[model samples]
Target: MQILANIIPYFISQVENFSRRERISFAYLSIENVLGFSKSDCILKNDFKINKKDIKSLINIVNQLKKNVPIQYIFEETIFYNLKFKLNKSTLIPRNETEELVKWVLQYKFNSLFDIGTGSGCIPISIAKNSNSIISALDISLDALEIAKINAMYHNVKVDFICDDIFSYIPKRKYDIIISNPPYVLKSEKVFMSKHVLDHEPHSALFVDDSNPIIFYERIIKLSSDYLNDNGMLFFEINEKYSGDIIKILSKYNFVDIELKKDINDRDRMIKAVMK
Candidate 1:
């Protein structure tokens, strides 16, 4: 029966099973979503009372968090590149590493761009918002494409979304830039990933066969050459473990200026190359 004004400390006490970091994150989200307050408000008004109606909502959210549902899934929306994007089980949630990939791409100039496996269209939509380049993005899941379409429309950016398998997709025209954050997780690596990610996010967008960790990278790199204008770039948010494997594949396929980059975590998570 504790009022909203005292919810943070009470919630923290309730979520003792979660790590301190997780507890803090949940507290912040509770204030923002449950109490309809900003992060700053949580600091300025620690004793802000919660309305009776939202108490049930807060309890539900906390319960879901206890079950390991990602906060993004609970909210059904997230911020990427400072732009808001809609989310669902159909698409992979955007990650900070992917944001680094977008930042890397933004460093270069291009006229036309394409994103394969464009889950929720976060990659292309974010790039389009920052650049004047014409953008086209594709995902095999029609459900995922719809979410992407919603985000594109929400941001008022025109991204041509196509629902088709990339292996069979033949581009109508070449592009100056082609990028993808395709399935790179080894099937065996599932245990290493968080349960929330394994259970909630679309698995097809995440995993590849353990025997072929770079399958999508190989296919996307080969297909990109056909679509890429000469000296144009191909960028990937990569698997850190496959840095050598990825580099070898790109070299065999005649790519140059191949470089591997790390995420904000300083983990090797991205790679870039050019069609030679």
Candidate 2:
């Protein structure tokens, strides 16, 4: 147990590629999960003794980290838009860009909303927390939908979760807004991604064949005209390299008021359009 005190420095040294802030954040998060301690505990009691069982668990996590597994997946949970969600290999972990998309949707006038590819249900649940609109979330992976359902329960929000591919699922009712953070990464780009993401995350939730990077967008836009009310909005978290291509697709569909947004990192990460 006393050995755990040495683990921090060791972890920081091993994670040299990470910024100091990232190291501290990951260390604190991993420790909290294993030791049930808070950030203050870590700060005020740097030499606090860890139990043997906790040490073993922490060591396992460290080994996983060494293999470039994402820390969020190591812990199996993460906070998105101030809400906690359970995550696993079955779904893509929620990202800040998705949170921004949710914020954009919450600001719009919508009587009912649908989240396409709502892995882990973070986006729709966060929106439901702030707005009174009826929400439904759809995902093709049943395993992902199970995690989403658990997240909805954990957040105490009522959302209709459908386990079906967004491209095939036709909504019986019209929605004023539809949001999605679809799989848009090109397979050719996978070689350039961080090992932490490419190795640990599910491929189905991340990649599209380079030959058809906009496949999901084309299908969604085609079906959206039927499900979206006149003047309804469509929001997407898009691949930055293909933003111009996405705009062309929306234009082809006759969607108006098209806009592209940047994330905090200044990457073109989101797009919005209105059904004309």
In candidate 1, residue 136 scores what lDDT?
Answer: 96
- lDDT values for all models: 0.87, 0.86
Alpha-carbon runs more than 4 Å astray in model 2: 1-5, 16-20
Q: Which residue pairs overlap in candidate 1's backbone?
A: 4-50, 5-48, 5-49
lDDT of 2 by residue, 1-276 (tens): 374466677678777757777777788787778777787877777788777887788778777877888888988989999888899999788888888888878777788998888888888889988998889999999999999999889888999999887766788798999888889988888788998888888899999888899999888887887789999999999989889988998999899999999999999999999997
**TM-score, predicted candidate 1 vs. hidden true structure:** 0.94
